[model samples]
Target: PSRTEGNTRLYTDEDLQRLEFILNLARDLGVNISGIAIILQMRERMEEMQRQIHDFVQYIQEEVLSRATAATDASRGAIVPVRRPMVTPASQNTRKK
Candidate 1:
C-alpha cells in the first residue's frame, strides 16, 4: 500500500487479491502469517516453472516446423526416376510353363 499527498492508502487489483488470499488463509484455514508467506512463495515458484516449461515447448515446436519447411522446400525440385527391368518373350514363356 502506498500513500498519496493526502496520506490516503491505495490498493491495486493484485494487492487486493493478495490481501484477500491472506485473509482467507488466516481466517478460514487458520494458517499463521509465516505459513501463508511460505505458501505464497511456493505458489509463485510453481507458476514460474509452468511458464518456463510452456516457453520451452513453444520453442521446440517452432524449431521443428521451421526445419520441416526447409526440408520440404529443399526437396521440392528433386526428381527420382525408377526403371523397371525389361522382360523378354522367352522369360514370359518359361513363367507360363
Candidate 2:
C-alpha cells in the first residue's frame, strides 16, 4: 500500500496481485493470517537468495572469461617445453626357496 497526495492508500497492479495471492492462501488453502505472513516472508527470502545466486554465477562467469582471455594473450609468444618422466621396468626374477 502506498500513500497518495490526498493521504489515501493506493494499490498498484503488483499490490493487487499480492492481495489476490494472500486471499487465495486464506480462502483456498485455508491458511491463517499468521501462516500467510510466514509464507510471504519465506517467499521473499527465497527470491532474494535466488537473485544473489544469479549474481554470483554471473560474476564467476565474467571472472573466468577474463582470466582465460588474459592467459591466452600472455601465452601468445611464449614457448612452453613439455617433458615426460622416464620409468624403469621392474625385474621379473623371484627369490628362490
Candidate 3:
C-alpha cells in the first residue's frame, strides 16, 4: 500500500500480487505470517543474486569481446604462420605384428 497525496492507501499491481501470494501461503500452504515474510525475503535475495550473476556474466563477455577486437585490429595484415605437430611413421619393431 502506498500513500496518495490525500494520504489514502493505494495498492499497486505489485502490492496486489504480494497480497495474493501471502493469502495463498496462509490458506494453501498453512504458513504463518512470520514464515511467509521469511520466505518472501529469501526469494527476493535469491532473485537479486541471480540478477547480479547475470550482470557479471555480461560484463565478462563484453570485456572478452573488446579484448579480442583489439587484438585482431592490432594484428591486421600480419601473416602468422601456423605450425602443426610433426608425425613420424612407426618403425617395424614398434609396429604391431
- Of 1 and 3, the candidate ahead on TM-score is 1
The residue-by-residue lDDT of candidate 3 on 1-97, one tens digit each, is: 7798999999999999988999999999999989998999998999999999999999999999999999999999999899999999899988767
Candidate 3: clashing pairs of residues: none
Strongest candidate by TM-score: 1
What would the per-residue lDDT of candidate 1 be over residues 15-90, giving only the tens digit for each residue? 9999999999999999998999999999899999999999999999999999999999999979969799998667
Query: RMSD of model 3, in Å?
Result: 7.6
> How much lDDT does each candidate structure score?
0.95, 0.95, 0.95
Q: How do all the candidates rank in terms of TM-score, highest first?
A: 1, 2, 3
Clashing pairs in 2: none
Candidate 1: where are CA atoms >4 Å away?
A: 84-97
